[model samples]
Target: MSGSPALFDAHLHLRDARILPFHARYVKDALDVGVTACIDCATRPEEWAMEVSSSLAATTAYGLHPWYASVSVPNWLERLECVLASDPNAPVGEIGLDGIRRVHDGGTAQRAVLFAQLDLAARLGRPVILHGARVWPLLLRLLEPWADRICAWQLHGINFSHELLALPFFKRANAWFSVGGGLLKPAARLLPELLPHLPLNRLLVETDSPDRFPIGGDPLVLGQHQLLYNQPGNLRCILRAAATLRALPVDELAEQTAQNARDFLAAR
Candidate 1:
């Protein structure tokens, strides 16, 4: 990997308990394979500190995921603010509406949490890492007001239609889209169509480690067996998939997306 361009895993969750024990292994593999950076996204309050601390070679983001919206913990917002304030440059994110899963109060609580984080991100002039599954339309609508205020934003693992690009907020400068390993699957829905429509400069790649594992391979096994665990090193596979879609050399795509990540993170 000496001559290969270093890669970036635009989104992942290093603080996940299942992955924690293997954290050092993941980092070693990522670095060994030329993965230079990543964004470790925290989904809740308890994981925030560890998320930041564990990202020794990557950027860190802390946010209240929509699934945890109904949590009745005291001073969560205040604590979140304290963490964001601790590192003004770190992103605010992994926050957005999720319509697919059942949550308390039919997503009302989720909306409240999402909106509050959006407001906070806007107020702090921080870039955001957003997650939208079955709620892209609502997410776009909710982000309308901060279209101008927010410094930058990345929609992680977005598999939406071309219509998303037409949204006012998406049209704004500094909007980004991260392509994950999911696109590598033969049955990928909107990615094949969506990738061709997106500007390469605004595109990024991520493994969403320990989550959206690519189709048809055991990431944890290389021999005859299979182990279905995603890791930061898997970013190489995603970069290859994206390179095929963009019709560029893998090294070229890696360089472009690396620069894109730098620019996106600098938005804060």
Candidate 2:
């Protein structure tokens, strides 16, 4: 690993309350292993505030995740806009629709919030980090109108499908695909098989730390619940697994994905 390229976690939540108390250790461990950069995403307004106050060294992204969509305060949109406006380089997201969570109005609220943020990103010419679970088609349909307007889209934790590649969003040069520890699961046969088919320049990697802990991940202890939290250091394990699936040397893949991450983040 002496000559390995520094890794980039394209999407994660270092500002997450669950792991914030020990973020310094998590960041240090990640940096020691060559994860030189990370895009720390805030799922809601409070987390955004935490990002502003925290000392974590990361490129910050702000948005309301679907799970928190219905619970957002009245002035959340205005606050979100202010955060993005404060930093032009920052991306807008970790935002999208999730059908799995039972929201009051059957996802109507999620769509409304998602559109507002998407429109804001387009207006400000910022890239977006999107999350769509059990609502991929609806997300795609929602994105079509703004596909050309937004600078870039990081489809975080994507589940690959050949049909998805044919969509206008995927056809655009601005689209990026980020994969995480979920790809290491035995049941994720499709992702491994289709991994090579994804455009290399648009592919990125992440840990989604404090969640999505890899199959053989290096665990960070969570004392109260006795839970295993995923840390950024596990990116090395993910990179190695991805390299094997793609039949490329780990270093080669690391550099490629790192460059891809830089391009995605720097877009616009």
Question: Number of the top candidate by lDDT?
Answer: 2
lDDT of 2 by residue, 1-268 (tens): 3677888888888878877777777777788788888898888888888733433358899999999877849899999999888888899989998866677787888889999999889889999999987677668866888888889999888775657667776555378889899888988876786688888888899998978889988887545553588988899898888989888999898899989988988889
Instruction: For residues 75-121, write the lDDT of model 1, one tens digit per residue.
Output: 88999999999977789989988877887587889888888888888
What is the number of backbone collisions in each predicted candidate, taken in the order shown?
0, 0
Worst 10 residues of 2 by lDDT: 48-57
The per-residue C-alpha lDDT of model 2 at residue 224 equals 58
TM-scores, all models, native as reference: 0.93, 0.93
Task: Report residue 23 deviation for candidate 2 (angstroms).
Answer: 1.6
CA shift at 257, candidate 1, in angstroms?
0.3
Which stretches of candidate 1 lie above 4 Å from their native place? 51-56, 221-227
